[model samples]
Target: MKNSFIFLFLLYSTILFSQKTTDYLLDKKEISQRELNSLSNFPIYKAYEFSDKGGVYNLVLGENQQKITKKDTLNTKIKAICAMNDHGGFLEKWSINDLLEAYEPKETNIWFWTKYCTLKDLDGDGYIEPIIVYGSKTEYGEVRRVKIITVYKNKKYVIRAVECDLDYCRSFKKDAAWNTLPQKVKTYVDQLVIKLRKEQNLLLKDG
Candidate 1:
């Protein structure tokens, strides 16, 4: 009977330890020369600093540009986002590559919507969730594609949308796993999408 009680106590303690929460804070930081050198492989354009129970973390966003030599001069753009620990070891990375094509009237443009990128513990989880938003546009900017990528617990949730005008999105897609997220996290992301659509003037009929 005493052993059974001890077993129960230990199990309870283990559950509490596994669910322990850490406070995380994120702030934009100037990239030092040393940090730049460390990330020399990436064309880093922006960076942020954050810390939790584990240690400090650096998050960076950049693009890899390569010239496309065809009939017309173009470029292949690869947007890269990464997070590294204090030891300079990469923790997570996300990337998307797209080819710049001449669309007769206008060329395709792809970029990160840095203003909406954020790091937060929306679900009150010990881990910080990194939310990244980016977009691509062609057809003389008449058609736009927006994407939001959020990483929680090393798992990614994605939301993709095609913007029509300035009122609603023409179409939107959410990963199946998105529906399984905490309600608060889902709400926060939904608000972010609304703000992005309104601020960017990318509204569709039934967005």
Candidate 2:
């Protein structure tokens, strides 16, 4: 029994250590970057299912997807995945461009944007930096946004979201409780970098 238990533990550890976190987005299973870019310009792009309840339907800049709307028959049945799972899902059929514009109040009821990441050696290290965007909407209609960047010794994922209104919206940018942009973003980015480094460390140790 002791030998059997030891063998099983070793097997589990081996499998766990062997797992590598590859880029799921760029993996061989899905469409290529060039194809995705081209499809983003399509008038009505098919939504790709990332998880069971989430997928993304791409659309052209000036066009719209009639299938994506508040009154659509399939709205309740489909979960429109954000470009990245780290980002959040949508609530209403706001204008795509509006949400895609900027992180502001007036930009509500339109589109969503996630291109505000700033990459620099924030820690004064001699290495290129990486930061990414993440945003989401809960079932209760609260918005969660996070920006993350990271390096070796430190990591974090600043996260913030709350029920929004006219009063809250105006103060969203400056409010400490509701805004998680710089801090949470930094956290998540750091987490990813640490994870990548750990994976590399394991690979090198094995090699």
RMSD of 2: 16.1
TM-score of each: 0.66, 0.26
How badly does each model clash, as a count of residue pairs?
A: 6, 21
Top model by lDDT, which number? 1
lDDT of all predictions: 0.63, 0.32
Candidate 1: tens digits of C-alpha lDDT, residues 115-158: 88877767765567778887766646554667788877667798
Over the stretch 1-207, how does candidate 2's per-residue lDDT look in tens digits? 999999999999876654432112233234444244333443322333221112222212222332355642111111122243224433322212212224443222222222433334443333223333333333333342322222222232232222234444321122233234346444554465355336423111110
Give the residue spans of candidate 2 off by over 4 A.
24-207
TM-score leader: 1
Point out where model 1 deviates above 4 Å.
1-42, 65-76, 86-107, 165-169, 204-207
Give model 2's TM-score versus the native structure: 0.26
Quote the lDDT for 3 in model 1. 100
